[model samples]
Target chain A: MILVAALPQQDILRLLSAQSHPAIYAQASNFSVADSEAILSISHESSFWKRELHFQQLTQAARNAGSYEIGWDGYDAPKPSDDSINQGIALLNKIKEAGLSPSSVLPSADGGIGISFRGQNGRRALLEISNDGSASYAIYGKGHPRLVGEFSPTAANLAVVFNRLSENL
Target chain B: MKPTVQHLSKAPIVEAIIAFALEKPLTDSDAVFEQFYALIQSDYPSRNPVKMAQLTVSDQGSSGETQIVGARFASADGKRVCLVDQSNFICSRLAPYETWESLKSEFERLWKIYSPLCNSRIARVGVRYINKIFLPEGEDMSLTVRTRPEIAEGLPQSMFNFLVRLGVKIPDPQGVLMITEAQLPTERPGFVTAVLDHDLQFRINPESTDVWSLLDKARELKNDYFFASLSEDVIKEYL
Candidate 1:
């Protein structure tokens, strides 16, 4: 749980300012403290998958480690791969094993995905969206599929996202 | 196993790696991923006046009704493809809706704050659905009102009005702005080139007076290249 809470933008800046690393700080320094903090806050709230958290932590760790190559991936949690294709596969696998009814995972001509699943009732759930190498998802729902909304990259937000999506089902 | 788009696109070196990986003579799956990565990392120009920072709405366990923004840039003939992701509540690179009303109000409010921050002359500004756009007359820029249901484009009208006030000429007679669901594939460099080329083309043609003025203004802005992905080195490499 890489402290997925959203700190105030000012606080994020203040923390970054105190960091020992200069290059990472400089790269991130341009963002207003408010923006940085908000993104972090959202990450914590969203339950980001592990890789997203690692990406966030990698910057701080690089600064802390005094090397740009260092990556702070929080492997503590069962974080999924950051690769979109792999994540898509992982998601499909999870849905399949969860004993949920048969669903179709359609690939878009544009390299995106369309997931169609049927609930115990006659309702249908469709998740059609894309990604940006970050934790961003746009979900729309119809019938009684349970959840509908968007998910964006932050720190530790995937768990929350999974719960929000499947808990009700 | 190769580098992910996020890994390569982040600043502080890796540009050369990206360029190297994406260079021509692409082969097999490895080459295909490289090509795809390049497309994902390409810089596409966004004419929308509303920055992501201003439009973000909070989601606090509410019904969470919001539209997602999506953008795809390509050549006029549709060649290279660049796909850009939208910030959750942040800047929208894609037109959320096909109508002008959706964006008019938000654009208006954002214009109030962003206009001073910009010195660029406005090109044709308004709700753009693919190549098509809905624009208002010169006088409409001032009289425009911001309302919830009015922004069919899901953009603020003020932002559109501000650009028109700054000198952007919206295309009229309607044919110039065509909207469709066709996804255009474009790489980052291709996208930037398209925008620059489109603006320059407009300037050379006398029929593009309004758009010309806006291009001139943008050129004079403090950071013309802020949104561009290719540096001089990258351009030189390709040339």
Candidate 2:
């Protein structure tokens, strides 16, 4: 015999509030269930959607990953250093200041951080920030040739990347 | 072909604004303010100081606001003025439209005075032109007739009012030029005002030293977008 039980509404609300992913909160807003069990079940899959991550959450994740151990493929990876994590946080703040959001934030193999953006119009771009404070970016679209370049972490250089990303946004 | 206007009795320009962003926020805005006051006080002796609150609203429906202190320096006629904020600079010219060259020259003049007080580089420069085109009364004054036919063909006949916005990339892909057009009803029964606003903007290297050249490029892009978006007849009638 199988048994079924429902969780309390208060617990569901708590679980939803604790979610750092923006899309999870957005999805939970429409959750019609009056039970906690259902909410908990769906919360497990919140991070599955890459686009659910918000800019603020990305910054927090980058900061928390200062000593991240997991690699991109679950293998050994270079953990982010304190300086690299700080630079990553600053880069995320600059991205928000430029009115942009990243699609994903991942720790790079070289103890750096990678911010990726997937445009609605099939354009894809990435910005890699090294621990030494150097930045490089690449942009590619369907009909255009790939654009790749390296730049310093100055406001001007960031503006160039921001401007291009804004077009896709 | 060079675009020229044969003097419309009533110019269509509603407002003209030129703004620039600094590479960094001024550490001591008060000192810069005093220097700006000393420079503009000669011509714009009358002043009406102003304060602004910058607000940022999160996607999750949260609000954050911060106070931004600034002042407005105006000419005796109140037609010309410069607004200086912590990191942003703006010069505006209202009705009785001055020619583009005159407005540009005035803004450049003010920029010269204000730039010296700041120890930051130029990050971005922008120029905006807002125009209100009034349609003639008792005629087939449809937007289709006033604007380029290509732009109007996409709309349905049942649509009474609409707003269309587009961002076009410049030749160098270094900037974005935005064009916004709206059809609004006027107090007069048969008259409607077509609001056309254009903004040309570009970001530059922080080490850039030639601010005027960027402004000039912005002006040229603004003109290009203005002419390309409207039909020649519309420009001749009201520009």
Best by DockQ: 1
Alpha-carbon error at B138 in model 2, in Å?
8.8
Which candidate comes out best when scored by lDDT?
2
B1-239, model 1: which lDDT tens digit per residue? 11112212222210000000011111243333333334433332211121123243556533433442323333221222232222111112221122223233333333333233322233222121112111222223112211111334555443211111011222322211111111111112212111110111111222353532343343222012221322333333322
Task: Report iRMS values in order.
Answer: 21.5, 23.6
Report the Cα lDDT for candidate 1: 0.27
Q: lDDT for every model?
A: 0.27, 0.61
Q: TM-score of each candidate?
A: 0.20, 0.49
Across residues B30-120, which tens digit of lDDT does each residue of candidate 2 receive? 7888888987898887564555445677787767565546667877555676777666777777666778789889988888888888877
Output DockQ, candidate 1: 0.02
True contacts kept of 2: 0.00
| All candidates: DockQ | 0.02, 0.01
Stretches of candidate 1 off by over 4 Å are A1-87, A90-169, B1-99, B130-175, B178-239
Worst 10 residues of 1 chain B by lDDT: B14-23
Error of 1 at B111 (Å): 1.5
